[model samples]
Target chain A: MNRYTDEERQLDELLRSASPRRTVPPGLDTRIMARIAAHERRRRERRAIRSMALTCLALSAVLAVVGGIAVRSLDVVHRPETLVLLLAGMGCMALTVGGDRIGEIMRRL
Target chain B: MEQPTDNEIVQRVAAGDTEAFGIVVARYSEPIYHLVAGILRNEARAEEVTQETFVRAYEHLDRFRGGCSLSTWLYRIAYNRAVDSCRRRRFFGLLPAHETLPEPDDRPRYDDETIDRMRRALGRLAPRERALIALFYEEERPIAEVAAITGLSPANVKVKLHRTRQLLRKYMETQ
Candidate 1:
């Protein structure tokens, strides 16, 4: 047991001496801060694009609904098939307005 | 003026005062670098991993509930990052043969060739074991904190650390 303690002590000293505290390179903090800034900028840009895409999607849906109701109340089409066709046209318009935005958001993601 | 505690800095950063994060980065970067460099044994990769650790901690600050000290959380991130970097290097077969060998600066400081042997022995140990050594000996962390950083139970940490020391001794004797 005594020999073990002695050996452990020697090893401890040896390890300590062998592995001195490594010095960090200069400007490491600057480099890290720069990276953090870049990351923050990217995050902000992503959030802005996402929010804009959501707004466009909401606007397109509202326009489609309002356009459909207006056409239905006008009674321009006597047939249910005509009303369905009008709604489908409005739906196509909405997709045209918002499709690219959605695609952009998806690609970014 | 007294410097703010880590919790205080964290609160400030979470409150949208992003500059306060610089304090955390500056305060922890060196020790994180040492711990990471010890594990990866590559200064450049260690630096990159250290920066990555801070960036990850910043992004995930909301998840920090103060269950552990900030340094412990940061150490955990740095350790995992270094390990991942090591794995990636190994996968690409780009890991150097002497990744963990001691630097040439030690030649003048320690005249004994045993120091070289000891460093070579350290290189032979697995990366996880080297992490345990760095956290235990270099950081002088308590077993419990080491456990927290390494995701090991305290009992496991103790056993592994004991075995690591014994292995180091054996290597030193035989090498």
Candidate 2:
């Protein structure tokens, strides 16, 4: 243990003299910040696209249900898939609201 | 007013204040660069890896729960980035394993020539060993901090550090 201590001291001294602490080059912070800003922009764009898609899906689901109800009232169709339209609308609503949570889960994966 | 702490800076960044992250970059860029350069032995590559580390930290700022100090967290990220870069280089055969030099039976000296030998010896060490030396000696971090950066237990850090010290001594003392 004493020998280890002695060696450790010598090694520490040698490394200190040989490899002094380096200074970061000028503009490194700027370069890093630029990259970070670009990444943030890309992430925001992706989220916007996701939100738009979800909203479209929900709106389309709503239109399908309204059309089904109108057709049922018209009494022209023998069978109206009102139940399926309601289930689709509910699923799309959940997806639109829970999009962020789903994103977090996917990122973890 | 007194300077806000690292947690404060992290919180500000997480709160959508993008400019606040520049403070984190300015504060840790130097030591993180030094640690990465020591591990990589390449200044340009170290700079690139340092930038990547900060970007990664920024991206995950919301996930930082402050279980450890900001410096420790940054050091851990920097260390991992450096190691991953090394692995990728090795995988593509871009970096060759450093060859060991023959030993001589003379007392070690700390001259310029000896410094050159020390550098070569450092290059011969594994990336993880270099990281241990950088955090413990160059950065002057405690054993616990070193363990945190390397994801090793404190006892494991001590044992690995002891063996690395001996290996470095032997390599530098060689002809």
Candidate 3:
């Protein structure tokens, strides 16, 4: 049969009573919530910047494509070099705007 | 109203409901503070580390995979932060070495004076030993959970708990 020792029981009671439930300072929650709010704000700002950059890049690409098609259909000039340059510019813009996200996606895949 | 589970609260926080994290903070702050304070033996430093622990939990909410209860995960973070703070303090000679207590006959009872003395004796233990005693005896955490929080094996935790109890007993017996 298991037995209880005087020392063990005393130690248990001592530890339990000694380690009282500490009262968190009233301002701690406010401070933590404020920090969380600040973190969220920074995250939102980063997302906003990324989205704005992506939108501008997309608009530019679409405009370039439409203009290229229009020029070709109107027979204004057979500028293959201009079309190639536009495509290259769009590629660079995509890389610049979404390079990190694209890399992350690819890494995940 | 039935309170949400920790996973639900974590989901809300992960979904950008930053205020939802307050629920987690309210639930854990006291215990986390006590745990940190027990190890650091400095209320100010322990409070700071507890705050940092919550902030870290918020930042890493998405990475929580529900592998363990949120309390366990939170305790683990608090434990690590307290240990780090203790090490930094020791590095600067800020933490004093464990003091040798004068042995008294018989174990001390838990009167007000004895309790105060016990608190002092606890402070005289090594930081990790204090942490082990706090988690095991005061917190009443399961051995597995304590092991997970402290990164010790279950068997090792049991052995350490035994030794820490003996040390505490010795300290408490001191005048």
Candidate 4:
């Protein structure tokens, strides 16, 4: 064997150990799993609410169209030459986007 | 009776028994951790990377083809996560994500003879180079396995492994 220093071998021996590995705390798994479960619950609720909102908005849109048509038919019966009510309905439709000045933001978004 | 295979756990996880995935985490976390720690070197960040690996694995399990072993797939995820964590550490101007070895007299266990010196030397290598050495020395992967895990061809792995060793040797000698 090549000449070996005692101190060097001792140091090499000392440095050659590996620490025992510990797992991430068990609670970490529970917390993460719990969060995933809760997130799924929240996601379903959010999707349901979004679908309901879309349905309500669609119903409102259909009602607006039908009411405008009904008013136009009335205008024809009462004062056939007048564009007043139809023009008013057109203005109402222009303001169709309804939640707190949403029309202005919708143009940008 | 057969104990559950990783593929079985994975299939259950995909079928919506999210809690069933904890078994997968519990089983693989240590190997996944050592692999991450080997590459990134910070114990705390390695723990975070291990956790994120499972999270990403869960998120992407549907895309996992059964052609490869589960651990191989997880290694791929862990590797990508470690790389991202390394980038984040660098971008934040933090010290590279590596653990400080205790003094030889102080640390009870160290597998690398020059643990501290090697770590300091490792810093000089590019991340991919460091990763290759780590997969060899730390993860104990053979060149073939390392190539499979890192997606390098065996020939490329050998070439890269040679350069990696030379770079570390240079660092050790110079340092």
lDDT of each: 0.84, 0.81, 0.78, 0.67
Which 10-residue span in candidate 2 chain B carries the lowest summed lDDT?
B99-108
**Candidate 1 local lDDT, residue B37:** 88
Off-target runs (Cα >4 Å) in candidate 4 are: A1-28, A31-35, A38-46, A61-109, B96-99, B102-113
Question: How would you encode candidate 4's per-residue C-alpha lDDT over A1-109 as one tens digit per residue?
Answer: 8555675454334323332243444565665555556766865666666665675577578767876676656744566434566556655764564443444334433
Is model 4 an incorrect, acceptable, medium or high docking prediction? incorrect
Supply the global lDDT for candidate 1. 0.84
Looking at model 1, residue B152 earns an lDDT score of: 92
TM-score (all chains, Cα) for each model: 0.84, 0.79, 0.71, 0.68
lDDT of 2 at A54: 72
lDDT: the better of candidates 2 and 3: 2
**Model 2 clash number:** 0
Candidate 4 DockQ, CA atoms: 0.15
Count of backbone clashes, every candidate in sequence: 0, 0, 0, 4
DockQ of each: 0.45, 0.34, 0.28, 0.15
Error of 3 at B22 (Å): 2.0
Ranking by lDDT: 1, 2, 3, 4
Q: Write the per-residue lDDT of candidate 1 for residues A1-109, one digit (tens) a residue.
A: 3546877777776776667567889999999999999999998888879797878868777986787677757654475766777778776886787777777777777
Ranking by DockQ: 1, 2, 3, 4
* Model 3 quality (TM-score): 0.71
Full ranking by TM-score: 1, 2, 3, 4
Q: What pairs collide in candidate 1?
A: none
Candidate 1 lDDT over B1-175, as tens digits, reads 9999999999999898889999999899989999998888878888889989999999999999999999999999998988888888889999777874545454344566877787877877788998998888877889999999999999999899889989998877787
